[model samples]
Each structure stands twice: as C-alpha cells, then as structure tokens.
Target: MENKLNDQKISSTIETEVLVVGAGNAGMMAAAAAAEKGAQVMIIEKEDSINLLRLGLAGVGTNAQKRAGMTIDKYELVEYLAAFAQHNVDEGLIYHWANNSAEAVNWVEDNILKPHGAHLRAEPDSLVTSSAYQGFSTENDPTIDDETFVSYGTWFQEKIAALGVNLSFKMALVKIIKEGNVAVAAIVKNISSGELIKINVSKGIILCTGGYSANEELLKKWNPLALKKNVYNDSPRNNGAGIVSALDIGAIKDEEPAECIFDRGLVPVGKKTEEMYVQTATYEDWLWLGSHPLLKVNLRGERFANESVPYQFTVNAASKQPGYLYAMIWDDNFDEYAKQFHTLGCARVGFPGYMANAKKLREDTQRYVDKGLVVQADSIEELAEKLQLPAENLKKTVLRNNELVKMNIDKDFGKEAYRLTPINKKPYYGCILGGRILCTSDGLRVNKKMEVLDANYEPIHNLYAAGNDSGGFFFGSYPDRVPGLAASHAQTFGRLAGQSAAK
Candidate 1:
C-alpha cells in the first residue's frame, strides 16, 4: 500500500463546499449542520450503511430536559468536568458544549425523532440521557431499506438526504491533499470498485473519522504504558486514518492520549469475541465495574489504591501489576455481600444477572467456578495456592483487611469505612479483574471552534476535526461517572465544526 501511494492515479474529482468524512454520530451531525447553513455538503462513509450502534446521545439543556423539569447548573457542570479530567481538559471546550448542546439536541429531536413519535429519554439524573424510540414501527417508511432498521443513524441519514446533502456509501478516505499547511482536498476510495476519487473542498474539511482505538500500532505508540493490557476496542472501524492524514499535513497532536477504560470481565485470548465474561468473586469481575465498591488486591496480595476511586485509576493500578490482573477476594459469607447496596443498589449501568437479581448473582458465581472463570477454596491458603500467590502474603493481607473492617478504617489504602468488607468466612473466593480501552481520546489538537490547529496555535486553513479526531477535550483518564460525555462531545463539537466550516 505504501509503495503504490506515489504512483497512484486519481480516477475522478468532485467539488464541495464542506467535505465531511465518516458517517457515525459526529459525521452525520456535521454534514446536516453544514447543509442547514446552505453549504453544498457531501458525506463519504466507508460502511455500506451508517450509524451502526448509535443508540442515543448526551446533552445538558434540551427540550427533553425542559419537559422533565430538569436543570443542571452549567457553571458547576463545567467545573465538575474540568476537575474530572484533573484540570487537563479544555475549559473553553467544556463551556462551549454545555452552552450549545441544548440546541443540537432540540434540532435532532425536532427533525428526526419527533416526526417518528420518538423523543429524548432524559433520566432523573442530569448526566444520564438517551434517545429512546418506543418501539415505533418504521415498517411503513418506504426509504428504510432494511425491514429491521431502527436506529438514530437511519433516521438521521434520511433527514440529511432530504436536505439535499449527497450521501455516498462505501467510500473511504485514503489521503488528504494539502497546500502548504492548508487542507485543500481529500483522496477517497470506492471500496467496491477500487477507484480513488479526489474531493476538493472550497470551504473546509471536517474529520469525524474517530480515534485510534481500533489501530493496535497507534495504540502501542501513543497509549502504550496506560493500555499495556489486552483491549476490547468497541469501534473496530476507527483506525486513526484521519489523525494520520492530519499529521501528514503538519497538524499538531494533543499533549497526551486519553483512554476510555473501564473494569471488565476477563478478555479471551487469540480471538476477538464480544462475549461478556461475568466475574463472580468481586464487583470488578462483572462488566462496567466502575460503580461497584469492591476490595481489590494486587498479585502480591497487597491492597494498592482505593478501589472505590475512579474506574480508570483502578485499571491504571492493574496495569502496574505483574500480569495486568488483580484479584477481588471475598469469603463464603457472600450473603453478607448480598445487600444490594454495592452490586444492585445504585441504578447505574446493569448487566444481565446481578443487578437484576442478587440471588442470581450467587448462582452465576457458582456456575463460573464450575466453568473455571472464578476460583473457590475451602480456605484462604488454598485460594492463594490456586491463585499462584504466596500463601503467607494472602493470609497476611486478609488479616490486615479484617483488622481494618473491625476498626472501620482502611489505614493503608484509605478506603472508606462502608467499603471495608472483610474476607474472613470459610470457602474463600477470588476472581481476576482487568479492563481494556473502548476508544482513544487523543488526536489532532483543535480549538473551541473545532478548527484543527498547527504547532503555532493557529487554525489550519479549511481543516477542522470533530468527535474523537479532535483533541483537548480529555486528558489522563475517561471518567465513568460522567456518563454521556463522549456522545455529548460528538453532538456539540460536530455541530460546532459544521458551523465554523460553513462560515
């Protein structure tokens, strides 16, 4: 592929006022916004159809929120977001999203959702928002090619196409043509015919091609230390093509790449399967273990950081472990843990069994032990033996943990009293806990207007980046508590990029 790049001949050429790449949430939003501004918008999507898994989006102040009588302090929310990123995030960008997202949400609802009898489902919590289609039958719509088609993307594409925006499918971005430091055009490939087409941009090019989570090479280079463990990348299509093309034209990169890390079940080796592995021993073993307050210990049978902290911090501690796996140990008095406070208490994201039925959680635990996903022992020593850790170390750690339980204080890790669960009862159990990056948060550095910037902090002429392709939105780690941040960024920044590029 590299050798043929120099001799490659362009098959055809097209011109557009705004060229939007990738047809995911951000890309479609960008194209619609540009077209609404009367720009000749052309969207090139690599997939046969777009909006594969966009269930819903996030927004702060919207018609849905207003109807629900919900209000979030924009100032406090911005401060919370900045502090969540440890002040490594862009405050201007946060404020921009907080202020502008309501309009975008209302636009999407009014244009695509309301007509279909669907609406934005705003949870009682301000952060948790979703676009719920109440089983609205689309079988009557003639434009729906698939009989089973029911997604925000499908509705959004139809709406945009009606607005005179050209939607081209099976077209992949191969390269970007730059004049000096300005992005002038892009080289796109037709996946079916193996034909390359040049798209000249008269206004600007907005790259919503997503992040480098799907590219292993880019992951090893940028997010190596943080994501050393095996990852379960959710977006298999986001291969960093946009970031690479931007960098090839001297687009500045973000200072550090952030990862969307969360505690998940044991990932299978040698094959990529979306199978959900449920951990039985502790809270982290189950999927989306961020909200679960469980006691975790490293390979040396030593409690490291506060387990109740952010999920990314826990995953970071696991990366520092010997094999990038930690143990969540508990005792046979599992009924003591049967209280729904930690597991089923909080109404956060839920898996199949535990959150639904606590009794089913124990049943699943035993089943996993039978399946060898969890280790069960008649004693702590035996559990240690099975885990391949020093027996004395395990015993000592359990002893210290019991002492902490009695005192209602975690002297070493500074764990809260309510979270100090002692592993004292017979039939001790343990399960390995670890998680992988769902996506990357670092890419081409962009300003508040979503304009791709150069090293000198000047916007690259006619070049913009939205969604994960843009940077300065996140740093250090992805906060699980924030809920709808990623979807919100895509909506807010994608619209911002479109408006700016149209101007």
Candidate 2:
C-alpha cells in the first residue's frame, strides 16, 4: 500500500478525506462514522434518497439508547449470527457490529428517528407462525434485520447529513483511480445531466457502492448456476458499479459467492402499484418458512427441494429452472394451517392473498397458462389440458406424491416429513413464481480491515470495500430465524471500511 500525495488535475474535481459510493445503509453508516471522526466525508449516491435497500424496524441500531433496558448480546449469540451469515463474515467486523450495532441503534434513537410507538415483542411460536426471528438459537439463521427501530437506515442517513457530511444524490460512481495499485480518486457521473465528474480523495476511496444483485449479467457471472435476475424493485442501475470498478482495477473477488435474497413473486415493485413486474423476488422466503409442506416445482411441475431447506437454495434451484417459473400447488388444508400461523403484527392472514401477492393477484391465472406459466383446474385432466401439459403425467405425479406422503417417504424430492400434504384441491390456483436470481453470494474478497484483496491475498492499499461488494462468507443459502445477519454485516463492514479509510 503506497501512501503519497496524489493530486490528479481534472476539469471539475472535489476533494475529500473519505469518499463513499452508494449512500445506502452501509454507505451512509460509513460516511457518518468517518465524518464524526472529523474526516471530510463526501457521499455519492444514485437515488434521490437511500432507495437501494429495504429498511424497516429490525436491528440493534442507534435507537436502543433510549431503551431503559437492553439485553447485552452474548458471544454465543454472535456465534449464531456467524452461522447465520454462513461464517464468511469478518470476525472483527462482526465484533464491531455485534458490540455496537445496538449502539448505532441507540444513536439513531437519540439523534435520528424519534420513536413512533414501536415495541419489540417476543417472536411467537414459529411452528405455528413461520418467523425466522430466533434470537441466539443455533437452530435458526439470521439474515433479516428484525430490529425495533423505525426506518433505521433512513434515520441514520439523516444523522449522517446532520453531521455536516457532504451528500450528493443522483451521482453514480463510474470509475476508481488506482495510482499504481493504490486507490486515490473516483470518476462519477450525474444521471440527470450526463456530466462526467471527478472526485479526488486525498485521504482514501472507500467503495461502499453496494452489490450487483440488480445486474443479471453480473449475477450469471457470479453464480453460473443462477437462473435469471429476480430482485424486487431496487435502483435497477445497481449494476455493481463499485464491484465492477474494483474488478476493472484488478481486484480479485472472494471465491465463495453469497446469493442475494431473491424475491420472485409477480407483484408490484415496492409501494408503487402503477408498475407491475411479471417475474420478481421479495419476501418469498416467508412462504418456504411457512408450515405448508408443499413441495416446490419447476414450470414442468416436478418436485424440487426439501421445503425446510434454506430459501437461497430454493431460490437458486428456481433460477436453474428452464422456464424460470414454478407452480406451488398445495391442498386447502395446509392453506388453512398456514393461515392460523400469521405473525403478531400482521393479521392472521396469508398476505393480502394466499401466502404472497403479485401484481395481478386473484386475477385469472390463464394468461400465465397461455405463457406456459401456471395451470388451474378442478380435475387433473382439465389442469393438464388448460396448462397444455401431459394429463396422464400430471395424474401420475400427484398420485406418486400422495403415495409418498402416505408412506412418509418423499424418495424423489426428500421433502421434510413434517406438515407433508398431498395437493388435492379442486379449484387449484396456479400462480407463476419466476426463478429470478439476485447477485450470487460471490463478492469482492476483503480482509478483516475491510480492504479489497488481490489474488495473492494482499490487501489493496488505500482502497476499502463494504456491503455486498465484499463477499466470501456466503456460499449457498442464508440461515433461518436469525434475521439481522445482512443488515448487521452491512453496518459492521461499512463502518469498518470507513474506519480503515479514515485511518
């Protein structure tokens, strides 16, 4: 890591001690931490707000300060977190976050989001209600940030701004300046005006530019077995500018790829009903985590994986499907069972519809049928006819499934014995679940100091990476019941990257 005074002459240039790309949760945290440390922090973002992530109340953020009593997280609990993060996480970063994530939450509470009457209640019986919020239990995985703070990421961003850090929106990073293997500056582009901007960082360039989940081509590159791109609406331009820029500068990424949380329900993107996505993925994990023993199937209606497997595996399998869609047909009995298992906050109903909702929920699934997507009918023959599938094959498949269910075998699919049921519903609803892949878990390898690594295992000097951009922990599916794994990692690595860059 070479350290020298670098002043590259450009037509328009801005200097800063720490330059953070992609002002999402992690990047915002990085900017705030660096700025609070008295670094001239400049954050470059692509969205009007921090829209690259889905931030809700879930995680030990700065808000916990007001909590009269907050339980201290134990090392055993962090061990579960490590397991949930699939153990590729930096122990130092995890220690930083595990010790101070609640502190960050407390800071947010004291400085940012004033409490809006949100309370952290005990997670109910997951057997009855499928919730992966298992705290400190090795039986569960924790990817979801099930904290009690109201919009932690947004509030934290606001706090960063309050710290007098320079915040620029609609500014996307296009390049990273490597002065003979040492990062020094970055090239940015204003999306509105097509103006190329150069940002010269005298201190360092901390690439917090997020992950490449929104990039289908990058997704394919990361995980060749990945089927198709399937993330619910995020900034579609999140084509991994940070990771790609690093790659262009010869950053050899970590080998074990972590799969992004794939959301593949045909639904409207975010709160916008005006737009409809035919194939997407969001919160589909809840379905797999539910008590419904329904075996998933490809567009060909064949049994896929054990329902209890990690949602990422199911997501990966779905991506590998040729049609990139599946029909999850279950009986009305298991349907009723799942209905009885809704969480505490939400009313005991499966979504606003059955299990999940898409853009055209409760609409006739015939269009899906026309596209060889889904089929619904009273009799198996009618279902086959309507779906243009082999009627005899469909009947045999159902019969075999029923026989396996009766015998508790599941020899073909290896489905979990619990909650097993045969699909014998008359008015079967055939919804299309497209197998859209998020960026695979493969990320830019980084060290404990959050420095990007080369193939020779040397940390690239003056360059730091955070968030999904720094991979190597996730190999396959994320664990269950232990939410907060991703968000904590984001906070942990982001802050670590900032600290490293500031130093």
Candidate 3:
C-alpha cells in the first residue's frame, strides 16, 4: 500500500473534454448529455459494475406525463419538488432541471432501463393510494431499475458507452486538482492494481459522486445532533469523496443532516426497506418507511404518517414527520390482513422493492421481542412496561385506538381513511420501525447558479456541483420521495454545470 502524491510504479493518464465523476443516474445523464453536445466524455465509477447498488427507486407523479404521451416538462417537475420541499432548493439549478427532466427521464425509461421480471413496475395497492390526492398517480409509467436514486445510472452508462464516451471502473477519487480557485482535474486511485490515476478535463469535471451519509466522522462533524448509525442498502463506493474534495476546496456545508438515511434501524427493516441490520432497541430513525406491509400502532401507538403515500409527505402531505420510522403494534388479524394483501393488491404492501416473504417477515419481527428489536407483552400493561413508555398513556392509547377503529379515521396521525382496525389480540407485536437515511441533505453549500459556494456563499469558479453535491438545494431535511428530487437536480444542475463548464 504505497500512499503518496506520486507512485512511479503505476501509469495511467487520460484526458477528456468532460469527466463525470460518478455513474449514478445524474452522472450518467450528465455524461450522456455532454457527449451528445459533442464533448469528449469520460465517466469514472468506483463500482466494478455500473448500477450495482441497493438504491430504492419509486417513480410516482411522472407516469402521468408518460401516459399522456408527452414528456413531463422540467418546470412542472421543479414545481412539484419546490412546493413539496417547501421551496427549500436552489431555483436556478432546479429550473435548469425543469428543462432537462423530461428529456433525461424520458430517454432513460424509453431507451436503456430493462423491464419485466421480478423487477417490473407493479400497480400500487388500491388501499395505499385510496386516500391520496389524485395527482400522485403515475400511470403507464415504465418500471425502472428498482434500485435507489441511481436506478437510471446503468442505462445512462450504456448509452454513453455506445456514443464512445470513455468509462473507467474501480477508480476511487482521492481529491481534486485546483489552481487559483479553479478545479482543473482530479487525483484518483485504481483501487484494484494499487495505481494512482490522473484524469484531466479540458471542459470541466462534473462531480456526480454523491453525498456523505456513509461517513460517520463527517456526519458528526457537520451535524453533531443527528445520529450516526448506518443501515445502507447501497455499496461503499458512494463514500462522499466528491463532497470532501469540494470541502477541501473551501466548500461549506449547511447545518442540516442528510435526509432519509438511518438514525438507526432494525434487521427486519430488510423486509420493507431492503437494508438489513441486527436487532437493537437503540436503532431509532423517525419517519422512515418500512417493509412491514401493515404497521401496528397504538395510543402511545399511532401511525406517524400515511403509509400508503410512499414519498407522499412531500407531495400532498408535507407537514408530517420527516422520516416516518415510528413503531407499529399488531396482532393476529393484522397478520391475516397482510397475508390477504399479498394474495391480491388490496393492502399497501410495504417493500415494493425488498419485501420479506410472509414467514420471514413474521419471524424477523418475532425475534425482535426477545432480541429487543420490538417490545412485547401478553397484556397491555406488560407491553407498556416492556416498551418503557408511560403505562397509563399506553393503555389509554390502545383504548382510544379501539374506539377510533369504529370511526376509521386517525385524527392524530392523519392515517388514511380505511376500515376501522384495532390491535387487541394477545401476544401483540410491537416493532420499532427505524428511519433509514438516503443521501446527505447537507452538502458543500452552493449558490443557486449551481456554483460551489464558499463559507461566505461566494462561488468557486472552475468549480461546480449538482445532484446530491448541492446541499442547501433541499430543505434541511430529506424528503420522502428520493427519485424525482435528485433526478431533477442531477439532470438540471448537471446539465447546467456541463453547459457552464463548456462556456
């Protein structure tokens, strides 16, 4: 392991008009778009294969645009995100995405993504969206890669390669080459052969390398109050080197924690969210969606938000909890309900991506009691004692829930209207659903023009950022919907970065 600025043993140098640092959806789109503009493009990916990560992709609102046989204009998508995130993002870069959204998303779906198999876009359960706003449906939308945000990354790479764009894999970026506040190129390492590689860019280096939720040290440094537990469904390649490089070059991070990533999580979460973890009571993430299919909640127990609306908190219900990973208590009937939901698409199935089989789902949840992944008791008082919640509060909560079950409305948690249900069975299940983080919402701060900004909010020239690289772009929180948010930014800001670099 020779670690030095220059290692004479290794030799590799390549130059291109534009060098894209990542091959995720945004990186791919940026590379493809740049290549289309007749720039010589090189895409750098650390993964041995493109799109080999556990990203969760849920394409909702855009399907309507596809159904009408019209590309959803970039502006409309921008409108969706801005309003959804309470206008917390960068307008200029988002507006640029508004222009590129349709073209980029449409192209990825129509051309590259493989469909029809275990990985196809199945219709949402009628129960899930029954109470949702009419605007949420994305009909006739093609099934995507079913990974996380980079679902479209693989397709984008193939198209770029076809156009003769050079793609380098297993390359880890250590830092950027800057001079006079301008980044001219990057210093990289060939992770496999112990080689140092330099990639020079004549146009500019587009860093789609992603955010820093993977780095516990960085997370604690940026936002000390937020938790540092990781329950990733992705690979280690996205360790946030791009952001670190930006920071070393005078990038400032907004104070918000990365959105949708884990504060802590349960091993059974793999049943719903796809990322598994060992059972632990300390694994707590607020407002995360899980794979339990049906969540069991009580007085002290109430569903935090609409389970049906995956990423809906941003669309029609923005005021709710940010992550939504609270606990749900259930009994035998609920189990039957989940079973029935599987038989047909009647109930809101939890893991549209990584659903645990019914038996496994039951077992994973059951082990939590002994392992403390969940609190259990034969009686309500015992359950409350086990949960460490206020006993009176717990009892009253269950009573109130039983009473409310008749009304079929949860005034407290805004549970979607449905048949009244009660959790009154013995051997009750009390599983703590922890939130899982996605990308860091807080990144090296940048201005609205997609320029990487300094601590004083001044632009760093010959330097630009897009995708998850733009921290202040989203409000201090990560929204429920992952795809459309970054997809919009990556395409729009990425394009803007490319065009600005070319200029």
Worst 10 residues of 3 by lDDT: 341-350
Tens-digit per-residue lDDT, 73-114, candidate 3: 345545766776677665664565445444554554555654
Count clashing pairs, candidate 2. Answer: 47
Candidate 1: tens digits of C-alpha lDDT, residues 1-503? 54246226878789999999988778888998998889999999887877534443456677766766766667776776687678887788888887887787778778887787666655443222111101110001111221222356667878998989998999999888877767889999999999889898999999998888777678778877644553455567788999998888788878787877666554422122223322221233344333355667777877777776656678787777776767778877664554533432122323211233455456756766776756888888898877766789888988888998899887887765676677877788876666656668887888887889888889899999988898887887875454456767886788889988898
Q: Per-residue lDDT for 1-503 in model 2, tens only? A: 22122223233677788899877657877787788778889998887777434432234422331232333345766676577766766555556556655555444344454443333322323332222334321111111233322335555566777788888999888778788778878888888887767887877777776666666566567654443424243335457788888888889886655665432344211212123222233333223322233555655656666654444556556656655444466543544545433322221133212324222222323344454444456776776555444567667777787888799766876655554566776675444443334344467888877888877879778788877777765556654344445655666677767877887
lDDT winner between candidates 2 and 3:
2
Name the TM-score of candidate 1: 0.81
Give per-model CA RMSD: 7.3, 6.8, 6.9
Q: In each prediction, how many residue pairs overlap at the backbone (N, C-alpha, C within less than 3 A)? A: 0, 47, 31
Once superposed on the true structure, which residue ranges of model 3 sit more than 4 Å away at CA? Answer: 1-12, 52-80, 83-86, 114-135, 138-141, 144-157, 228-235, 252-255, 262-264, 267-326, 335-378, 381-393, 409-416, 445-461, 481-483, 495-503
By TM-score, the candidates rank as 1, 2, 3
Instruction: Evaluate residue 135 in candidate 2 and report its C-alpha lDDT on the 0 to 100 scale.
Output: 35
Task: Please identify model 2 stretches exceeding 4 Å from their true place.
Answer: 1-9, 56-100, 115-154, 228-235, 261-263, 266-293, 318-325, 332-335, 340-375, 403-418, 438-440
Candidate 2 C-alpha error for residue 254, in Å: 1.4
Cα lDDT listed for each candidate = 0.70, 0.57, 0.55
| lDDT of residue 482 for candidate 1 | 48
